[model samples]
Target: MDKFTTLTAVAAPLPMINVDTDMIIPKQFLKTVERTGLAKGLFFELRETPDGKPVPDFFMNQPQYKGAQILVAGDNFGCGSSREHAPWALLDYGIRCVISTSYADIFYNNCFQNGILPITLPKAEVDKLMDAAKRGHNARISVDLEKQEVTGPDGGVIKFEIDAHKKHCLLNGLDNIGLTLEKKSKIDSFESKQHGTQPWLYAQAGR
Candidate 1:
């Protein structure tokens, strides 16, 4: 996981509701556990035609939105199955943040674990950002986690609320594994004490 303190980058507008996990990476691409190459399969059906050619009209396929690090999406984003791969694909495609009016609970949790910031804002605010994102190369959205604020291209700022724990995790780049590692010394000490207290249990393990 990477620290997500602040970001100022191009935001691609995806104004479709109920964008599910399958629609994100597709079932065919779910066979691999590796995260790197999943970007090729990100929004595969929406991005490609029957013959596997790129869809010219798709937001992601457009040249101006290439390398976009933010996504301003519609409501119910990341719905359906609780697949961690959805966030993996999004992160691999360089989407560090997703701003929507709402999101599925499972997918929202998965985003934080994978270092993707899933933001929930009111419909009016999201609509404004979506419009800013539509301005092509000129509009770059800025997100600051510490301040819990999003600055649109036109210099308008919108404040958002997030759980303090989640904010801390993102600021420190702490995933579940990273959080556990932070207590390694305590874990080691506990294990050492347990070993001394239960010699017979340790001996049975040796068998």
Candidate 2:
């Protein structure tokens, strides 16, 4: 996971509600566990035609939004199955942040684990951002995690709230494994003590 402090980049507008995980990466692309190439499969159905050609009208397929790092989407974003690959695909496609009125619980948490910031704002605020994102690459959005603010192209700012612990983890780039590693010394000491107390058990396990 990468540290997420402040990001200022182009935001792609996706105004559809109930955008599920399957719609994100699709079932056909779920064969691989590797996160690297999933970007090609991101929004697979919407981005490609029956012949596998890029759909010209799609927001992500458009030239201006091809490299967008932020997404301003409609309500119920990332709904349906709890697939971790959804966030992986988004991150791989360079989407560092997603701003929506609401999100599915599992997908929201998955974003944090994968270093993507999932922001929930009021519908009005999200609508404002979505409209700004419609301006294409010209309207860049700024997301500052430390300040919990999303600034629009015209300099308007909307404040948001996030869990303090999640904020800390993202700021320092700590995932679940990273959090566990923080207590490495304590775990090592406990294991050493246990080994001394149960030498016979360790020998049997080794066999």
Candidate 3:
């Protein structure tokens, strides 16, 4: 996981709601446990045609949003089956944050774990940001995780709420594994002492 402090980048606007996991990465691309390379399959159906050619009409397909790091989308985004790959795909595609009026609980939680910030803002604020995103690469939005505020292209600011704990974890780039590693010294000491006292546990009689 990467530390998310402040991001100033182009935002892609996705106005459709109920964007499920399948639509995000599709079922065909779910076999890999590896988080990398899933970006190729991100928004598969929406980005490609029946012959597998990239569609020109898609927002992500447009040249301006080719490297967008932020996404401004409609409400109820990331609904349906709880595949964590959705966030993985977005992250792989360089999307560090997603802002919508609302999001599915499972997907929202998954974003935090996968180093993606899923922001829920009011519709009025979202509309304002969405319009800014439509201004192509020239319009960049800044998301300050520490300040919990999104600064729009035209100098407008929108405050957002995030779980205090989640903010702490993201600020430190601490995932579940990273959190565990924070206590590595203590764990190592415990195991060393435990093995010395209970040597039988480390021995494999069969081996």
Per lDDT, the best of the predicted structures is: 1
| lDDT order of candidates, top first | 1, 2, 3
Distance from true position, residue 198, model 2, in Å?
Answer: 2.4
- Model 1: lowest-lDDT 10 consecutive positions: 198-207
Best to worst by TM-score, what's the order?
A: 1, 2, 3
- Which segments of model 1 are wrong by more than 4 Å? 204-207
Model 2: how far is 66 from its true place, Å? 2.7
Tens digit of per-residue lDDT, candidate 3, span 87-171: 9999999999999999889999999898888889999999988888888987699999999999999898889999999999999
Position 35, candidate 1: lDDT: 81
Residue-wise C-alpha lDDT for candidate 1, range 46-160, written one tens digit per residue: 9999998988988888999998999999999999999999999999999999999999999999999999999999999999999888888977999999999999999999999
Query: What is the model-wide C-alpha lDDT for candidate 1?
Result: 0.94
Better of 2 and 3 by TM-score: 2
lDDT for 24 (candidate 2) = 94
Off by over 4 Å in 3: 205-207
Please list the C-alpha lDDT of all candidates, in the order they appear.
0.94, 0.93, 0.91
Ten-residue stretch with the least lDDT total in model 2: 198-207
Greater lDDT among 2 and 3 belongs to 2
Angstrom error at residue 84, model 2: 0.9
